[model samples]
Target: MYLYLQQQIQDVVKEFAKRQFDVDANVVVNQPPRAEMGDMALPLAMELARTLRRAPRQIAEEVAAELKKLEIVERVEIAGAGYVNLYFKRAAYATAFDQRTSGASTGKATGEKIIVEHTNINPNKAAHIGHLRNAALGDTFVRLLRSRGRNVEVQNYIDNTGVQVADVVAGFLNLEKKSAEEVRRLTEDPAVRFDYYCWDLYAKVSRFLAEQADGKAMRSTMLREIEAGGTEAARMAEIVSTAIVRAHLKTMHRLGVEYDLLPRESEILHLRFWDQAFALLKAKGAVYLETAGKNSGCWVMQYKGSETEDETAANEEDTKVIVRSNSTVTYVGKDMAYQLWKFGLLGKDFYYQPFHTYPDGHVVWMSSSERGKPSPAFGNGKIVYNVIDTRQSYLQDIVAAGLRALGYAAQADRSIHFSYEMVALSPRCCEEMGIELSPEEQKRPYIEVSGRKGLGVKADDLIDRLTEEALREVAARHPDKSQETKELIARQIAIGALRYFLLKYTCNAVIAFDFREALSFEGETGPYVQYAVVRARNIFRKLAEEGEGAKPVAISEATLAKFLAPPDGDAFWSLLYLISQRDAAAEQAVVTTEPAAVAKYAFQLAQAFNNFYHRFHILTEQNPERKAFLLWLVRKLEEQLTATLGILGIEAPKAM
Candidate 1:
C-alpha cells in the first residue's frame, strides 16, 4: 500500500522537478498532527528544496499539481514551508483496514537464522525487579521479530555454577553447618520456595563474610569445592540452581516471557567447546601468556590502540586471565567459549533435552548431555543479539574480539551487544525496602541496586503487591463479579502495568524505580493502554446489544473496508485507518532494536480511538446504520490496538 503511494508521489515529483533525481528518494510520509492537515503528508518539497535550488513552497505547488493527476490522491495541497499534503480516499483506507486483507509490513527479508538470548539471570536466588525489565524487553524483541516473519530462537543463559551459586552453597554447608542429607531434606520442602528462602540466606552469608578480617580463607575453601565440580558443595549448588531457575521461569511465564533453550555455563566447559576456542586463540597468537606484568602469568589479548578512556577501559586489554594462576576460568574466559559456541566455530555442539515449554511461543529445551535429535538451527545464526546490561560491556566487547580473532569476523560484526543501563531504586523505595545509601553517596542522581546485599525490590514481592492492589481496584470497579474473574482481571492489569513501566524509557536510560510510579495506572502506562482497549471493548459490547439486538454483527470479520460508505470523507475513517498500520510500527522495531516503538504505536492508536470515541457518538448517531458502522469501526480499532499490545508482551483487561 505504501509503496504504491510512494511510487505515485515519486513519479509526480520526478516529472515536476524538471531535473532528474532518483525516483526512490526515501520520501518522508507522516500523519498530519491534525485531521485537517491531511491523511498523509510528504514534506518532499522541503526535503528537495536545498538540492533543487528552489524554495519548498514553489516545488510543493508544482509537485501537488502533478501528484493530483495520479491515482491514490483524493486531493493534494501545498502547505506551509512547501509541505505536500495528500488526503487518502476513505474508501481505500476502509477497504485496507478490513481485517481479512491487509498484510504485515515485513516478511523474513533475510531468511537467515537468529538467536536472541536474554534474562540469563543466575539461578541461585529469587529474581528481582531488575530481571523483570530484562525479560519484558527481550520477550518483546522476540515477538517483534516473529511478527515481522523472522525465525527467532529465544534462549535463556543459565549461570548455574557461578560465584553466586557457590555463595548459596557456602551458606548451607559452611555457615549453617548442614549435613548433606539435612541440606537435601531442606531443599526438597514443597511448602517453601528454596530459591526465595535462599535469597535472604545468601544476603546473611554475604554480610557475615564481609565483617570478617580473614573471610578470604572461607571463600577460598568454597571456591575449591566449586571448581572440583563433584563435591557436596558443587552438588548442593546444582540443587539450588535448579530450584531457583524454576522459580525464575514461573515468574517469567506469568508475564508472558518465554524461551526456547537454557544453555548452561557448565556445559560449555564439559563439552570442551572452549578448549578448542582457546587453542585457536593460542595458535593464531591472538592471545599470549603474560610472564611479567600487573596481570602477570595470565593470558591476554591486547586492545586496538585507538580507543578513548571509556572504550579503552574495557578494550585496553583483551588481555585477561583465561586461566588464573589458580587454574580457574575467569568469567571472561567462559564467555569467550560461549561466544565461540554461539557462532558454531568451536567444532562442538550441545545435546538437546526437553526443558518445560512456556505458554507463549517458546519451546524450552536444555543443552543435552549426549547428542540429541536436531532442532531448529539453534546457533551459528547470521546474527546474534545478546540482551545483556551495560555492566557487561567489558566482557561483551571481548566476545566481539574473540569472534574477530578466531577468523569469524563476519559473525562478530553481526553479533550485537544489546546493552541497556541498570535499574535503581528511588530513595523512598530504598527506605521502604530498608536498603539505604550513605549521605555522601546520596549526592548522586540514582541509587544502585545491590542484589548481593539484598538492597532492593524482589521480583516476586513486587508482583504480589501489584496483584493485591489491583484486586482491590478490580473489586471496587467490578463488583458482583466472581472471585475467579476478579483475580483474572487483576493479574492482567498487574502484568500490564509492570511490563509497560519497565519498557517506557529508552533502553539505555537508568530507571530509578519508585513503587508509586510503577504501580500507577494513570498517565502513559501499560494498563492505560489496556484500559483504552477495554473501553473500546465496552463500546462494542454496548453497540452489539443495541445495534443488532443481541445478534452477531459480523464484527470480527469487519474489515477497514466497511468504512467506505457514501460520503466517506469523515475524519473518523481517517483516524481508524491509522489503526491499520500496526505492521509499519512492527517494522520500526528491527531498525531501532528498541521495543518502545511498539509501545509508542499502542499509545498513538489509543489516542486515536479515544478521540474518535469522544467526538462522534457511536451509540447516539442519527441513523441506526451509521451508528452500527461506527460501532464496527470501534471494534476494528480495538482489535488492532490489542494486537499491538500483545506484540509488546502486554495484556488488555476487558474490564480494566
Candidate 2:
C-alpha cells in the first residue's frame, strides 16, 4: 500500500507541477521518521521550489491540495519546511499490505543451479565462536536463496591437504611418534573431542617448529612426505583431518547448519581436477611462461584488470606467479583451479559419493572415486557464492580476475565473494578467557581472536553457557516443570540466542564477542524474540481452552489466498507481508549477503506482533465478528514468526 499510495501521490504531483512549471515533474517518496507523520512522506516541494522560484512550503500546500482529491487519501498535510505528509485510510494499510505483499520481489534468480561454497575451515580443530559467524551467515544466505525458488548446492570445502592439516600430521607422526592405527585409537577416545585434541596438537607442532631452533628442517621433511602421500605424514593427516571435519559437522548441526556436499582438497588434487584446469588456462593463453622478468622461473598470468576505469589502475606487477621456480603450485594456483571446476569451465568433475545422510534427512555428497553408482549433477552453477572472510579479499579478487582472463566472464560476473569480517573478543571476554592484551591490541576496539594461540571461545563452550543460563531462566518461570522439559526449553533458547547473535551484524562488520552481552535474555536478543512467539502461542492456547469459545479458529490455504489478496486490510495483513519479503531479503542479502538484515527483520516483526498483542484482547472481545478476526490475525502472526525464525536457523521455544 505504501508503494501504491506513493504512486497515486506522484501522479497528482506530476499534474500539479506540469501546470506550474510547464514541464514533466519527478518526485521521490520516503518513510516518515515517525509513523504519526504519515505512513509515507513526500518531499517534492524543495525540488519544485528551485524550479518555480517559490518557497517550498507554498509548493507543499499546493501538492497537498492536489492529493486530497483522491478518496484513498484519508489526510494530506504540509509539515516542516516543505514535506507533503500522506496518511492513507487506516484500513488501506491492511488492504494494500494484503494485496501488494502477496508477491513481493523474490529476486530475479530462477530455479537455476547455484553453488555456495562456505564454512571451508580446515579440519584441524574444534570450531570456535569465530567459525560460527561464517557458517551462520552462509547457511542463512542459502535459506534466503532457496526460499526464492533458487536451487542451491551448499558445499562445505574441506582443506584436508593444507599446511594446517600438515601441522597436525607432524604432531601425530614426528612428535607423538604414533602409528596410524595407534593414532586412530588415541583420537577415538570419548573423553576428548577429536577436534579439540588435534587443535592443541596442531598448535604444539606449530610452536615447536617456529621456536625450537633445531626443528626448522623437520617441517620441510614433513611437507615432502605429505606431498608424496602413502607416508606417515599423509596417513596422519588423513586421520586428523577426517576426524576433525566430522566434529565440525556435529558442531554446525547443533546450530541448524548443514552442507549438501563435503568437497575435500585432496580429492581435487588426486582426481587431477587442478591439472585439468591448469591445462585449460595454458591452452587459452590465460597463463604462460614468464621467461624474461624477475618472475623468470614462474608460470605467470598477466594481471587481469578490474571493472573500474583508470589508466594507472592496472596492477603494476605484470603477472601473478602461479608456480615458483619449484614445480609445486601455490595456494592461489590451487584455488584458481578449484574456481574453474566449480563453474564447469575446467571441463573436469569430481566423482560424487553419498557422504552422509543427516538426521534431518538431508543428504551430504562427498567428492570421491569410490563412487559405486551414477551421480547427482553438481557444480557448473549459473551462480556461485563463496562465503569467506574479508582478509582473503585480495585472493578472491584474483580468482575472479582469473575467471575473466580465461573467458569465463559470465561466471565471473555471477561468482560472488560472500565476505565477512573476523570475530574478535571484547575486552571483558578476553579477560574472562584468561587472555592478556598488549598495549597495541588494547588500543583497538576489540582483541583479535587467535586460533593459533587458542585464545577465543570454543563453539561448544558458548553453547553450554547459553544453555545453562537459559535453563536457569526457564526454571524460574516454571518451577513445576520437569527437569527434562526445562532442558529442552533451555536448548531451544540457547540455540536461538547464538544463531541470532551470529546473524544480527552486517557481514562486513567484525564482531566483538562478549560473554555478558551474548548471555542477555532481554532486549535485542534472540530469546526475547522467541519469548514473544511463545507468548502469542500461549494467548491462542488460552483462547482455545476458555471464553465464549467461538468456533475453533483455524487457517487454510484458501483462507491464506484471501488473506493476502485484494481488500487485504486487516490487523493481520502486516504479518502476511513478511512472507513475500523473505525472497527480497535473500536478494538484498545476495548483494549485502549479510544475515543481519534478515535477523533484524525477524526481531522487528516480532516486536510489532508483541505491541499488537498489548493493544487488543482477542478472547475477551465481546463482538463475535471482531473476536473471530483477531484470532485469525493472531494465528497468522504466530505462523509467520515461526516461519521467519526457521529461516534464521532459530527455533521458537514452546516456553520462555
Candidate 3:
C-alpha cells in the first residue's frame, strides 16, 4: 500500500514538473521524523529551486498548491527548507486496505532463473551450529526472492570426494582395519547414527595425523584412492558420505530448510567435468603451467587481485594452483566447472536422478554420472548466489574471475558471494553443555566451533535441547493442552527460536549461540513476535465469546472517513501506515541481500501492535461504533502480522 501511494505521488510530481517547469525530474519520497508532519515528504522543490531561480520555499508552496488537487492527497504542506509533505486520504487508504486481496502480486517479474547454493557442508560428519547459519541465511534469502516473484532454485553442493570424507575413510581403513562390507553394515545399523560415528572417527583421525609421522602420507593415499573410485577405500567413502549427507538433510529439514538439488563432486569427477573446464581454461589462457617457479609442474591461475604491477612484482602468494603437480584437480577447478554449468555457459550438463522426496512432494535431485530417471532440468540459471562463509571469499572471487577470463562477463557480474561470518558458542552456552573451557576461553565473548576437533554443537543436538526447553515452558503455561499438542507447539517454537537467532544478526556479524537469549519470550526473540499474534487472536476470541460477533463487517468509506477525522485517530492511523510498508521492507531486504532487515521489521511491528493492544480496550468500551472500529483495527493487525511472520518462516500458534 505504501509503495503504491509513493508511485502515485511520484507520477503526479513528474507531470507537474513537465507542465509547469518544462523539465524532467526524478521525485524521491521519504518519511518525516514525526507523524504530525505527514505520511511522506518530498524535497523536489529544493532540487528545482536552482533551475527556477527562486527560493526553495517558494517552489515548495507552488507545488503544494498544485498537489492539493490529487485525489489521494488529503493535504499538502510546505515545511522548513522547501519540503513538500503529503498527508494521504485516511479513508481512501482504509478503503484500499479493505479492497486489497491477499497474495496480490508485488515486484515486477523479471522471468530470470536464480540459483542459490547453500549448506555446502562436507558430507563427512554431522552438521554443526556453523552449518546452521549458512542454511538459515540461504533459505531465508530464497524466501525473500520468492516473495518478490523471482524464479529461484535451491542447491546444496556436496563435496563427497573431498579430503574431509577421505580422512574419515582413512580412519575406518588404516585405524580400524575395517573393510568395505563392514562399513556398509555399520551404516545400515538402525541404532548406530553413522554420521555420529564418523564425527568421532574424524576427530580422532585429526589428532592422530598431528601426532603420527605417517598420518599425512596415509591420508594422501586415501584421498587419491577415493578420487580414483575403484578401490575398497573409495567404496567405503561413498557409504560414509552418502549416509552423512542424508543425516544432514534430516537435520536441515528440522529447521524447515530444503534443497532442490544435491550436486556432488564425485559426479563432477566421474562425468569428467573438470577435464572440459581445464580445456576451456587452457584455450582461454585463464591458467598456465608454472614450469620454472616453486610451483613447477602445477597449473596455476594468477590471483585475481594481483593484476597490478607493484603487487605482481612483490610476488605475494598470488598463484592459485588449479591442478596439482600430481594431476589432481583442486576444489576451485571443479567449482569453476559447476559455476559455468549454473549459467549454461559450460556447454556441458549433469545427468540427474531423484534422491529424496520431501513431505511437500518436492523431489530433490542428485547429480549422477549415468541417467537413472527422467528429471526436471537443473541449473541454467541467469544469476547464481553462493551462500558460503566469509573465510572462502577469496576462492569465491576467483570463481567469478574464472568466468570473466572465459568471457562470460555477464554471468560473472550476476554471480554473488552471499558470504557470512562463522557461528560460535557463547561462553555460557559452552559451560551449560558440559564442555570444559580454558580460563582464557571463558573470559572471551565467544569460542569458535571446530568440527575436526569434535568441539562444535551438533545441529540436531541443539535443536533437541531447544525443543526440550520449549516443551517445559509450554507445559507449565498450558497444562490444559494435550501432551501431543504441547509437543507440536514446542517444536514450532524451537524452530522459530533457532532460525530467528541465526537470522537476527547481519550477514557480516558473528553470532554467539546462547540458549537463554534465543528462547526468552522477551525482547527481539521469535516468540515475542509470535506471542503478539496470539494476543491478537485472543482479543477476537473474547469478542466472539462475548456474543459481540468479532467478525468485522465491511466498513463503508463514509464511516472510515468519520472515524479517522479527529486527533484521537492519529495513533491508529500511524499503526496502519507502518503495517502498510511490508512490501517496501521486503524489497529492501532483497535488494540489500540482508535478511536481518526483515527480521527487524517483524519485531518492530510486533512492538507497535503490543503498544496499541494495551492502549486501546475494545471489549470494555461501551460505544458500539468505537468498539467495532477497534475490532477492525485488531483484525487488520492480525492479517499483516501473520503475513510478516510467514515471510520469516515462523508459525504463530493459537495457545502460545
Top candidate by lDDT: 3
TM-score, candidate 2, is: 0.85
lDDT of 2 by residue, 1-656 (tens): 44345566677778778886685877777657875576568888888788789999988888888888887677888999899998765444444454443355466544778899989888888889889999998898888777656888899998888777877777777788888888788778888778878777777888877887767567656656665578866888888787888888888988988998888777777888778878878888888876764777778776754444553335336468887565556677888888887877777788878867788788888888455446678887888898999999878888888888788888888988988999999877777877788887777789887777767788988999999999988999999989999999999999999888888888888899998878887788898889889988887778657754634454343544444343544445454444334444545565577778778877887888777788777767887666666676666567667767878889887777
Runs of candidate 2 exceeding 4 Å displacement: 1-29, 41-110, 212-221, 291-296, 304-319, 547-587
Model 1 TM-score, 2 decimals? 0.89
lDDT of 3 by residue, 1-656 (tens): 88777888789888998998898988888899899999899999999999889899998888898889988789989998999999989989987876773445676555889999999999999999899999999999998888778999999999999989999988888789999899999989999988888889999988988788887777777788899999999998889888999999999999888899999999888888888989999999999998876788999997755656786454438778999887888899999999988998878889998999999998899999997788877899998999999999999989999999999989999999998999998999999889899999999999999988898888888899889998999999999999999999999888888888888999999888887886676788888888899999999898889886777677678777777765978888888888888877888888898999989988999999999988988779988777777777778888988887777788898778
Candidate 1 lDDT over 361-390, as tens digits, reads 556788865787667557767678999999
Model 1 residue 476 CA deviation in Å = 1.7
TM for every model, in the order presented, reads: 0.89, 0.85, 0.94
Q: How much is 459 displaced in model 1, in angstroms?
A: 0.6
Worst 10 residues of 3 by lDDT: 101-110
Candidate 2 global CA lDDT score: 0.77
Better of 2 and 3 by lDDT: 3
> Model-by-model lDDT, in order?
0.77, 0.77, 0.88
Model 2, clash count?
4
